[model samples]
Target: MSKIYVLDTNVLLQDPHSIFSFEENEVVIPAVVLEEVDSKKRYMDEIGRNARHVSRLIDSFRGNGKLHERIPLENGGSLRIELNHRSFQQLQDIFIEKTNDNRILAVAKNLSLEEETKEDGKTVILVSKDALVRVKADAIGLLSEDYLSDRVIENDHVYTGFLEVYTAKETIDRYYEKGEIQASEIVTFPLFPNQFLVMKDALGSSASAIGIVDKSRKKLKKLIFDYDHIWGIKPRNVQQTAAFELLLRKDLPLVTLTGKAGTGKTLLALASGLLQTEDHGAYKKLLVARPIVPVGKDIGFLPGEKEEKLRPWMQPIYDNLEYLFNVKKPGELDAILAGMGSIEVEALTYIRGRSIPDQYIIIDEAQNLTKHEVKTILTRVGEGSKIVLMGDPEQIDHPYLDAYNNGLTYVVERFKDQMIAGHVKLIKGERSGLAQLAADLL
Candidate 1:
C-alpha cells in the first residue's frame, strides 16, 4: 500500500539522502522541516554539512519537477512538499503555542488524519532522528519511526572477527611442536587473516601459544617496529597486540577498537602511534584527537588559547603520553612535546576542512561521536594515512547516543567487510588491578 512519510529535520541531518531511502514510498517534506534544515545549514559542523547537502539535494530534485507538487522519482515512488498541513490549528487547540516542535507534530497529525489518503485507516508515517519528535508525533495519533538509514549493523549481527571451532587434540599438539602447519591440513573451519586461535586441547593439556598462520600454513609475521629501544614502553596484552596491527597497517586506513575502561585501548593506540610517527619514519606526524563532551552542565566559557582551552578536554590524552614518556616533572612532557614537533593533540572541533595524509591519526573517546561526525573524520583522511578510532562504547556521554548507536560501533559494523579495516573488543583490562576490578564490577 502506498503511504506518505513525513520527514523531520533530524532525519535529513542524520542522512542527507534520506528521501531516497524509503523505496517506492511517497516522501513528504513539511514546510516546517525546511525551516529547521535551513537553521542548521549555516553551522560549521557535520550537522551543518548534512543540512546543506539536503538543501542541495532538494534543489537538484527541482529539475525533475516542482517539489511543491508531486513529482515521480526514479524509483517507483514520488516526492512532494506538504504546505497545506494545519498542525498549527490542532496544536493551538492544545498548547496554544506555535512552537517549532508543535508545528512539526501538527503537520504529521494532519497528514495522518487526512481522509483522502487513508488506506485501511493508515495514511502517513513520520520519520525522525529526534526521539522527542517521534514521541510527539505518536501523542498526536501519528505513526512515527526513527530514521535508521545511517545504522550500519543490525542488532546482534556485528562481526567479532573470531570464531570458536572444535579441532582435534593431535592437530593442536603438532601445531605447537612444529610451530607452523599447513592451512589445508588444519581442521579449523573458520579463520580470518591475523585472527588468533586458542586451540584448546580436547584432551586437556597446557598447549597454547597465540598464533596466526596463512592459508599455506606458514606462520604470519607479528607486528614489528624499527624503534627497538627508543622508549621502554611495551604492549601489555593481546588486545594491544591486535591494536598494533590496526595502527601500523598502511593498507588498513580505518581501524576501530571498543572496550571498557582500563582495557589499554587508548594507551596501546597512543604508544603505537608514537613509535611509528616519533621513533620510526613511517609517518610524518602523530595526530591525537578527541571530541569535547562536557561532563556536567556546561560552564559555557573558557579563557585561553586553543591549547589552553583544549587542556580540560584533552588532559586524558596528555596523561597517557606522560606515562608513556616516563617524565617526572609537569613541564618536562611539554618540553618533550615541543622538541618532537611530530606529536600533536588537537580537538575534533578544528579538524574539519583539513587534509591529513601520511600521518597516524588516533581519535580517542570516539563513542561520543555520531555517525555523521565519524563519516566527516574518515572522509578527511588522505592517501597514506591510517586512522584509529578507540573508545569504550559503554562509557558514551552523548545525550542522544548509546553504546550500540555511537560512531565507534557504527564504524566497526559498517566497515567489517573491508580488508583494510579491523575491529577488536578488548575483554581484559591491563591498566591496574584496581582498575580492572572496578571495570569488571562496575
Candidate 2:
C-alpha cells in the first residue's frame, strides 16, 4: 500500500533535498511548512543557508511540473502541496492564537481524514524531528514518525572500545610471561585490534589491567600517569576507558568521538594530546580547532584580529588546556600558548587550503560540521598527522546537520571498518556533579 508521508519543516531545514528520500509513495508538504521555511530564509548563518536551499529545491521542482498540483516524482512518488488540508477552524476553537504547531497538526489531521475517506484506505504518516509533534499526531490518531533520514548507528549502541574478558588469571599470566598472546587464545570473547582489554579472572577474582595488543601479538607501550588525578574528569566507566584507547592511539590517522556534554570527550582528547605531544614526543605539535557554531546564546562579535574573534568559541578549548596545564595565574596559560607555537589554535575557516603534517589535529564541536566541510578538513592531513574529531550529537547548533548525517558521525560511520581509523562514544559524565546531573536530567 502506498503511504502518504507528510514532511515537517525541520526535515526540509535539515536536508534541503529530503523530499527525494521517499520513493514510490506520496510526499505531502503541509502549507504551513513553507511559511516556516520562509521565516528562516533571511538570516546569514547555517539556518538561513538551509532555508534558501529549501527555497531553491522547491523552485527547481516547478520546472518539472506545477508543485502546487499533484506531480509525479522521478522515483515513482507523487509530490503535492496540501492546499485543502489547511483547516484552522478546529484548532482556533481550542486556542485563540494560531500557533505553528497547531497549524501543522491541523494539516496532518485533515490529511488523515482525507485518506480515511478514500476507498482504498491508504495510510497517512506525519514525519517530524519534534517529539511534541509526534505526541500531537498520536493524540489525533494519526501515524507519526521521527524523521530518521540520516541515522548511521543502529539504536544507541555507539562505539565503546573496551572489551572485558573473563579468563583464568594464569592465561593472562602466561601471556605476560611469553611477552605476547594470540587474539584467538582469548576464547571467552571477541577482540578488536588496538582495543584495550580489561581481563578479570573468571573464577570471581579481582585481577584487571588495561593492555592493548595487535594481530601479530605485539604489545604497545603504555603512557605513564605523572599528573594529579583529574578529579572531575575521571572515566565514569569502561566505555570512557575505551574512548581513551582511541584518544591515545597514534597509529590511527583518523579518530572520532561522540557523546553528550560533560562526558569528558573534550577533556580526554586534550589530555591525551598533551601526553603524546609534550611528554611522549609522539607528535611534533598539537593543532586544535573547532567549528565556530554559536550555541543558543551568542556573545556578539569581537573587534580585532582572527584570534580575538576566535576567543569566544575557542574559550572552551583553552579552559581544558588551562586546567590540564595547571596554570595558577591569569596570563600564565596565555604565555605558554604564545611560547609554544607548537599548539596552534585557529577557527575551522582558516584551516582550509592548508596541509597539516606531523601534528595532532583535534576538531571540537565536529557535529556542527557539514559533510563537505569535514571532507575538506580531513583531506588536509599530511604524512604522519593524526586528526581527532569530537562533539556532542544531541547539542547540534547547525540547522542543516543532524545526529545521523552530521559530518562527525558521518566520518565515524563511514570509516568504522577501516583499520587505520577508530571511533569511541563516551557515555559517562566527568565534568562535575551538577553538570553530570544536568546532562542526565536535561
Candidate 3:
C-alpha cells in the first residue's frame, strides 16, 4: 500500500534527492521544513549547499502543479506541500512550546488524522535523521523512521577487507614453498581484490600464514611489506600489519584505514607517506589534509593568515608529523618543514578545483565527510598521485553522519572489489590499556 512520508528538515539537508527516494508513495513537506531549510541556506558548508539544492528541487516541481496540491513526480510518486497551519493543541500537554519540531509533529499528527477519516486510510510516517525527533514522534503516537537511503552498509556488517580461512597443513606447506596458492584450493567463498587473509591449518594447529588475494593472478600471495617497522612505528597487531602493507604499496593507489582512537590509524598513514615521499622520493611531495570540523563548541574564528587560521584545526596533523620527524622544540618542526619544502599541510576546504600530481595525499578525519564531499576530493587526484583516507568511524563528529553512512565507510565498501584500492579495520587499540578499556566500555 502507498503511504505518506513527511520529511524532516534534516533529511532534506542530508540528502537533497530524498524526495524521489520513496517510490510511488506520497511525499509530504510541511511548511515549517521549508522555513528551516531557508534559514540554513545562508551558511557556508555542506548542509547549506544541500539546503539550497533542496529549495531548487522543490521550486522546479511548480510547473506540474501547485505544491500545496498533489503534483505527480517523475518516479510515479506525488509530492505536496502541507499548508495547513497546525497548532500545538494536540501535543500541548506533552510539549508546551510551539517550536519548529513541535510544529512539524503537529502537521504530521493532523495529516494522520485526516488520512484515517478517509475511505481508504494510509499510513503516515515521519522520516528524520535526528534520533530525538524520532523519539518525540513516538511519544506522540506518530509513526517515524530514520532516513537511511544513503547508508551503503550497516555498522555490524561493515567490510573489514580481511578474513580468516583454514586449509590443510599440506596446502599451507605448499603455499609457503611456492609463495602462492589458488583461492579455490582453500576457501569456497569468493574473495575481493586485495582482500587480506590469515591462512591457518584446518586442525587449528599453530601453523599459519598471512597473504592477500591477488586479483590479477587469482591467487593468494604473501604480503608485500611485512617489515619490523615502517620508520620506527611498528605494527602491534595483525590488522595493523595489513594496514601498513596496504599503505606502503605503490600498486594500491587508494587505501583506507579505520579504527578506534589511538589505534595508530593516522600515525601509520603518516609514516608510510613520509617513507615514500621523504625517504624514498617516490612522490614529488607529501600533502596532509583533513576536514576542519570542530569537536566541541566552536572557538569562533582564529585571526591571521590562512595557514595561521588553520593551525588549531590542523594541530592534530602537526602532532603526528612531529612524532614522526622527531621534532623536540616548538619551532624545530617548522624549520624541518621549511627546509624540506616537500610536506604541505592544508585544509580539505581549499583542495577543490585543483589537480594534484605525483603527491602522497593523506586525508585524515575522513569519517566526518559526506559521500559527495569525498567524491570531490578523490576526483582531484592527478596522475601518479596516491591518496590515503584514514579515520575512526566510531568517533564521527558530523551532525548528519554516522558510522555506516559516512564517506569513509562508503569508500571502503565501494572500493573493496577494485584492485587499486585496499582497506584495513584496526581492531586493537595500542595506545594504552586504559584507553583500550575506555574505547571498549565507554
For each candidate, how many residue pairs have backbone atoms clashing (under 3 Å)?
Answer: 1, 0, 0
Off by over 4 Å in 1: 88-97, 116-122, 164-166, 182-191, 213-237, 245-254, 352-358, 368-385, 397-407, 432-442
lDDT of 3 at 19: 96
Global lDDT scores for all candidate models: 0.77, 0.78, 0.92
Residue range with the least summed lDDT across 10 consecutive positions in model 3 = 83-92
User: Is candidate 1 or 3 superior in TM-score?
Assistant: 3
- Candidate with best TM-score: 3
Off by over 4 Å in 3: none
lDDT of 3 by residue, 75-170 (tens): 999999999847667889999888999899999998898888999999999999989999999998999999999899745799998898888999
Against the true structure, what is each candidate's TM-score? 0.84, 0.82, 0.97
How well is each residue in 332-357 modelled by candidate 1, as lDDT tens digits?
Answer: 99999999899999999988899998
Ranking by TM-score: 3, 1, 2
Q: Worst 10-residue stretch by lDDT in candidate 1? A: 221-230
Residue 356's lDDT within candidate 2 is 89
State, as a TM-score between 0 and 1, how close model 3 is to the true structure: 0.97
